[model samples]
Target: MSINGQPEKVENIYLTTLNEILDSIAPQNDLELSLNSILKILAKDLHFQRAFLAIMDPKSEKLKLSITHSPAKIDHVTYSPGKGVVGRVYETGQAVVIPRMSENTDFLNKAFGRSDEELKSLSFICVPIKKGNSKEDHNVLGTISVDSPILPMDNLLEHKQFLEVVAALISNQVSRLQEEMALQAQMLSQGPLLGGQEVPPPANFVATSKSIKQVLRQARQVGPSRATALLRGESGTGKELLAEAIHACSPRRDKPLVKLNCAALPAELVESELFGHQKGAFTGAYQNKRGLFEVANNGTLFLDEIGELSLDAQAKVLRAIQEKEIQRVGSEHPITVDVRLICATHQPLEKLLKEGRFREDLFYRVNVFPIFIPALRERREDILPLAEQFLEIFSKEYDKNIKRISSPAIDLFTQYHWPGNVRELKNCLERAVLICEEEVIRTYHLPPTLQTAESTATDTSLSFGEAVAKFEQELLVDSLKKARGNMLQAARDLRVSYRIVNYKVKKYNIDVKKYTGAKKNK
Candidate 1:
């Protein structure tokens, strides 16, 4: 008989197994160890061939293998959202049941390197692990899946429901683990703490986006070589930061890295600034000087806004790059200088070359290895972490103790378009730090543009259910604040029974102590 149609004995056995699994997850045990243990029990008691958990990567938006009960050597496996059954469950925040893997054409068995023949007769069930009632909330963290060849197909619905309950039980633990990981990362980024003061460590490139990571990997690969690298990105996308990272990781790290902004200087002085000039070369040429080429000899010279260089300056730069020699503006003899060039530009160099504003040959020389840094809007997953880093920095600078960004503020941050990219984000956080009075930054502390955008977005995008949920949450918070977190009083004020209010509080996972000034008696 199918498990669903079996006697009460089978139902009792299932409940007992679930309770045992839940009880085994102790707070003191390692998360992975506890999860694996539970999976083993599930595989044995539930007659499943294999069970596994996959956690969603917030940056890449991919589901990565976390723990599995199978003995097969499956590691380093990842699936993009909507790629496989597990991924589809993660993407849609819904449960999926496959009665027979062979019949389902969409079933991709690549997650564990299993071929179609191996999974032909298996049945699969995948369910999302979420912390909130609303599937649209950011609380859908990951997915848990199980498969078995001998399991009855008629009880697929029963199995799906049971897996969902298991997922809900595990969601709280997963959320706690995620919070701990975030805290540890923040502490590491802040460096060692001595007597309540933060000793800042040397800055490093911070990014979690997969695209930026790929760019950084390419930078590291080319750092050890003498190849000319062209960094192309919009303004405020941190081109200079990538340039510095390259220089620091290069073989000439001990040598000086010279930087000059072509657009910042006058056209008349551009050539002189780059090639230097002899004593009395021009009206204000007071003494003999060394050019940037000589200063950066055996090191890297980062030429910012290379597209802004005049044709005259471009010719001299090309010659220096080609022959490894430069001539002082008024000197006859050419001086040999060895320097690696790193160029950056916000403008499209190809278009500039076509317009005769840039030298095509010079462009080829610099574009040997081009790295494109994605704009902030293109990598929204990095937004919160970057904002937190800035918050730590400006909080220290302003002598404030701001500890965190409120969830609502972070929601607004992820929604708004970052026109100015990372630079604008830093400035925004700095301003919020200066004006914030509490330890948390709220939505009101953000710029007016964010507020306007959020209002417009809510009006047009939020569904009726989502809008109702938002209003309900706000009402609960306000009621709790007024009642000093006394559930009885809050329910009376809202004209609801104490049982209903308590249920709602638990459903939302609201922390009652946050609304009350009272401390725990324990």
Candidate 2:
């Protein structure tokens, strides 16, 4: 079969590939779906007379033939330890190449019940699958053996090597798949917090998609610079997290990090909060107060919601940043501050400047370096992992024994649009954990907004269930980030009872212990 002159059979199998199998496996979470799918595709694509995979049993010390592509009407055969080439190679954890069929006695001829004479024209190759670690324990997870009659010696060896490569690929893919799957299970079961995993960046930090890697690559560049940085994105896109990350990676990481939420503070307090005030400078000022600048002296100060600052406040900020000194509200002398400024805003500063809501000079001052964070919808690939992370966090916080987010719940999450970005997703999952009674967070427990958004988007062809699932997945992961895997604390932050939270812990089956905790101040 041919499609556009390419092998149609091969194309069909490759095109039929699904990521579900990959989603089912995790580090210790073993599932055979991914391995099976790869073998299926390989067998069909190469038109091999017989193809099958065998993974070594963890405790059995025996090679278990997990998948087979042999013709029906024949029972599948299992080789005893070191009985045949496949078993011997698996046992020794090395590659064994059979140059010719009749040369080796250890080469069993029991594949698909084929007689030795009939199988004589066929050559085989087997290689052991190994895991990465200092110890490098050799385990024969399985063998990918291909049989072909009337094949050339060179072609046979090449195909053998190719099959070995496929085996290695399967091993790696399985490892990732199992890890991801286990993470998902843990996220859902454990209420997004269990065993104390470090909370991840917000769901708005989505980067699982192919396109978002470039976005992250660009964002990473802004960290080392002394120039003022501007981060632009939709609200809930986790501008603050990115800003903090930048500060953490900067040269002044050892200094205090002062954050000013320009939008949250009143206009009267903005100037004083930023530049400091002398005693009796204002009606409530009985004593001198160090502003964010003084507090962050020689460190980095994050100015969030910069677009919300009034022109007057913006002017004061501009002066201190440009001159490296700030005069107190009622003081005669200017105090020097060696602080680095990193600003973030969801609003389009350029548009605001054009509309006269933001000052152009201030814009230019902070815009010396700009980092744009992509929205959750833009980087759907990161959704599920992030969600799993959140589930792990919340599970532990709520003190619930929940294990994971149900498959359907993940599917639902990936389908919705996160209008509020990571923040909104965090609220939604917290709510779900509060309401869910099962070990897993299911579709019924999802936020009403998510369901509504998914429905509306699907109706208009604007989004699909799969997309929402990805979004929710990211949000769930983001929520687990704050506590560094301390599920009980995560639950308190979410304001949910411990039991419900623990249910999610069990449902997602997350191991919070693996979450890397936040490093202490160096």
lDDT of 2: 0.66
Question: Which segments of candidate 1 are over 4 A away from where they belong?
Answer: 1-202, 454-522
Please give, for residues 1-522, the per-residue lDDT of candidate 2 as tens digits: 454566655334434432433333322233355465556665555555666665554445556565664553445456666778878876676666666667678876665666667557666667666553212435445556666554666766666666655555466544333333333343344342323433343334545665455545444445555657777788887777777777776778788888988989898888999888999987999998988899999898999899988898888788888789888899989998888888888886757865888875576567655677778877767778677667767877887666677555676677877777677777777787777786667777997766566443344543676667555444444345445667777678668777856776665566666544742110
**Candidate 1, residues 123-224: lDDT per residue as tens digits?**
889899896345673567888888876456667778788888888778755655554444344444545434343222227567777777777766765676
TM match of model 2 to true structure? 0.49
Error of 1 at 320 (Å): 0.7
The per-prediction CA RMSD against the true structure, in angstroms, equals 23.6, 23.0
Specify the highest-TM-score model's number: 1
